[model samples]
Target: MNLKSFPDEHLQSLTSLEYMWISYCPSMDNSFPCGLWPPNLSNLSIGSLKKPISEWGQQNFPTTLVTLILYGENSGAIPFAKADDTRNTATTSSFLLPPSLTYLYISDFMDMESLSMGLQHLTCLEELVIISCPNLKDLPVTLLPSLSRFWVNYCPKLRKKCSRKGKYWPIISQIPDLDILKAGRT
Candidate 1:
């Protein structure tokens, strides 16, 4: 924890601080606060923190957030598209998450290719996990048929576009707990 200057009210006294898991902490670079979070933060796992999350410009998460985890540290090629300084640049950047989400996890983004719809504000997303993100290709095919649980591991182009005749498998092929993990299987 080589913390380098994080002084935005510094967690604001725990008000029953719901699960917060700040990960790897690459020298604890001075981002991670747009305001004091953790006023009942329902479960957040902000990532490796070398000042990515697209420069951490605006994040205010505390609508009792429902389980969000991200562990990408190689810096953003599109780590949920941040840097929205009142729409001043970066191609009208959007995707600011926390629409009272219901579990979202993305891991080890080694230069993400596409999370393209930027999850469209997560519309009560029921559960999504993509681990180890090996050059992830694309998802957010209209949020994967309103996912009731979907996982993709080690993403070799999302295990070849979610296989079974590919091209995203007819939009997650009626997902009711679909899990696609090949290409180094977990």
Candidate 2:
């Protein structure tokens, strides 16, 4: 079913839910109820929502959440970084992501200026896919160690710069099992 707006109170009741999909909720701009999400929650998909994920992280983000899918028209611009002077680029909150997370998909992030510093906390991430974001200049260096699959498509600004040398592309190529997916360079 399509969930446009879920009451904040309902978040507490889904303690055993492993997978959650909330999309197209333009007005959802608050933390998900902390008590409802089970620690073992695995798959999570949030799309077209306005709530900053870092706020949700502070309220007890399920450590079991693995495989996160971020989509929607502006959802990718949630700014999952620490709140500090570094905010000049772009930042969210200081929410910590579970170490068990492996796969992350980001789409429609065309307005993000940069990634959040809090991203370094996720040490177990394996796959990262960024698509349709025309403004991403570079990928976070901290995201390289555990990354196995790397995909970037339809990001014109990022691709143009990456096509050259001496920047982040060289570092990206060194990823152990990287699979770069560009617009047509696949």
Candidate 3:
């Protein structure tokens, strides 16, 4: 796709658009303005853009949205567009997430080292899936009580850290359904 930018509030007119996927947008240099998103949009998959979502600053996504999937690149994802284990509280989070989400997926962020930085605000989350983040070193110390299903795959560090006897096991062990697959196998 050759998209570079869209006028502010351009997409707000489409009230019937329930889902939006903005992937493979390497040429996109800017983000959608606060009021530009479709009013009823529910599912959003955003990634592969010039700027990682972590550094997009505070965002105001649709309240009707429930599922979110972010595909990462080899680059980082935080301040200055680099990821780290900041452990900032929900009140000082670097990026804001849609609080109404029920399912969230993060994948392929080779330089990312943590997930807790952006996960604290989701009180309605029910499922979380992480995949292919080979360098990720930590999972949330405490998942929201609403979450019941969790999965991770191809994340070498996570597999080792979340294993039965691994250090982070206790954090994820309480989820009702959990699965961690070996790297390069699935």
Candidate 4:
């Protein structure tokens, strides 16, 4: 279905919703409605969003969220503070994620260059998947102690960096399962 606008009242009423998938809705222009998300929401998937990742922050994210999936060719960067932004910058970013998150999937972001360091906050994250983002280049250096599975597909530069002998190997080598798919392969 085509949704042009999502009203706050409509979203606030789904207090018991656990999973929601909104895709193929090009007419929607707003970041997932802030402060209107149900407290019990655990999984959310949004596709074809034109808004920047910077527009979604802690306030909009449900603390109960466990999985997040974003797919859109027009999506923007995953906002995070720079490592050098502070003296003790190992964990400092205005961009906050819910601690309950376990899986994160992002795809088709044509303009993305790097993942935000803010992801380090997801201490409970177990799986991460990035697909079809051609411009992505780097990943955060912070260790994801709980991450057991990592997957990347159709990201040329990122694939090169994550190679066995590449610069990103040290960062991802600890993961129990790692899959890197080249272009044209599933």
Identify the candidate with maximal lDDT.
1
Error of 3 at 62 (Å): 2.0
TM-score of 2: 0.73
**lDDT of model 2 at position 93:** 42
Worst 10 residues of 4 by lDDT: 84-93
lDDT of 2 by residue, 1-186 (tens): 334456756664667789887766677664563424555679987766665443343333577888888774754455454423233212224334566778888877667646535466677888888777777766668776567887778777666655636366666776766554556321
lDDT by residue (tens digit), candidate 4, 57-130 = 42346788999987765656655543233433322223445778899998887777888465656678889999
What's the count of clashing pairs in each model shown?
0, 2, 2, 0
For model 3, residues 26-76, the per-residue Cα lDDT tens digits are 888665535246779899887778766555554556788899887876336
How far is 83's C-alpha from truth in model 4 (Å)? 13
Candidate 2: segments with Cα more than 4 A from true spot: 1-4, 25-36, 50-60, 82-95, 164-166, 184-186
Clashing pairs in 4: none
Question: Which one wins by TM-score: 1 or 4?
Answer: 4
Error of 1 at 165 (Å): 5.6
Residue 139's lDDT in candidate 2 = 65
lDDT of 2: 0.63
Best by TM-score: 4
Is candidate 1 or 3 superior in TM-score?
3
Ranked by lDDT, top first: 1, 4, 3, 2
Candidate 1 residues lying further than 4 Å off, grouped into runs, are: 1-3, 7-39, 43-45, 51-65, 75-101, 110-125, 129-132, 135-146, 149-154, 165-172, 176-186
Give the clash count for model 2.
2
- Show the colliding residue pairs in model 2: 81-92, 81-116
